[model samples]
Target: MYFWFLLIVKSVFHHITPVPKIALPTAQGFSFIALTDILYFKADNNEALVYYLKPYDTKTHSAVIFKRLSDIEAALHYNGFLRIRRNYLINTYNIKQVNNRAIVMANDETLYPSRDRGKVVEAYLKEHFYI
Candidate 1:
């Protein structure tokens, strides 16, 4: 019952509320990153490597966020992120190209999806990349 209630609340609030910026703790302080600026997240065991466009800067930067990929995905999936692989959670807007076995990101990083997710990736490519 609690799970269902939480799901309902999330669904209802997800549409009405603006997506929140993810807070990343650093040695100096905390950094709040806008979801739109994020490119992708690479899972590394218990933490994730976040690649994002720096504000007012053309270069992309990376930070190690102390959260599991699944946790990050849970917070971001509703806001244009896709779990293409077990190790990669990508922002759909930053996808440059999608091949049969690999995806090229905006910053030229290539990632591979699991074979089980091939159909979903292909569908996304067909719907968005192809005419």
Candidate 2:
């Protein structure tokens, strides 16, 4: 069968040929300047950094550019991340604890799930915020 032939070829090539290095030449990794996807840049002098938002790219083997942190918050809110506070957007998958007063993200980071939302954070976490 064609499938068997292809498999044999692949196996032969994989064993005989040196492992071909496949990598995204740095341009594709998460950048602080563009943290939405695969670009990361940070300003050494500035107190507040301007991060770019991108998503992952399968073809490029990198996260794709989405938008800025603010933009991401506006879009993915309650869907992929929990807005623990104005500055911290905790991926619910990263959450380790929750109580009446606060939600704990990894690295011992804790944030009050904005009491104004009442049970919105808890409810959203229950529905979305996957691991």
Candidate 3:
């Protein structure tokens, strides 16, 4: 069953891989972000916030876009990045530190934990990172 599932997933994503360029305001300049992990972001304006995930790079400025966060997650197979919480989806690479109430970003953007999701998020992070 697992083998069949693997085949199905491989074939499903064989042609839908992301192909875009990410331009960052950093010393590395611009890069070809072949596949980036974007988490769901919904604001009051019926839009979503998205950031590009160019792993293992030294870029700070992420491309923020308004999108249908739910739709994007379903198509991505939930593979590359972990949806830690509903409102906050971070590319683990850019996650600098996790305190009790917030996840700090490389750009010093301290995003607060979801209103009712601190304990769950903390436990998940600890288990996943062995912290």
The ten-residue window of minimal lDDT in model 1 covers: 122-131
Q: lDDT of candidate 3 vs native?
A: 0.56
lDDT by residue for model 2 (1-131), tens: 99999999999898786422112223656433222332121222222122222344233222333334565466555345455544445455556677666765443545575666647776776666441
Which candidate, 1 or 3, has the higher lDDT? 1
Worst 10 residues of 3 by lDDT: 37-46
Alpha carbon deviation, residue 96, candidate 2 (Å): 0.7
Best by TM-score: 1
* Runs with alpha carbons beyond 4 Å of true place in candidate 2: 1-69, 75-79, 129-131
Cα lDDT computed for each candidate against the true fold: 0.85, 0.46, 0.56
> TM-score of model 2 relative to the true fold?
0.42
For model 1 the TM-score comes to 0.75
Q: What's the distance in Å from true for residue 20, model 2? A: 23
lDDT of 3 by residue, 1-131 (tens): 99999999999898787554333333566544444433223332444455544467555434544445565456543443445567555555556787777787665667776666677667767777777
Clashes of 3: 0
Put down candidate 1 lDDT per residue, 1-131, tens digits, no spaces.
99999999999998888756888899999999988889999999999999999778879898999999999889877677888888988998888876667888888888888889877877776776672
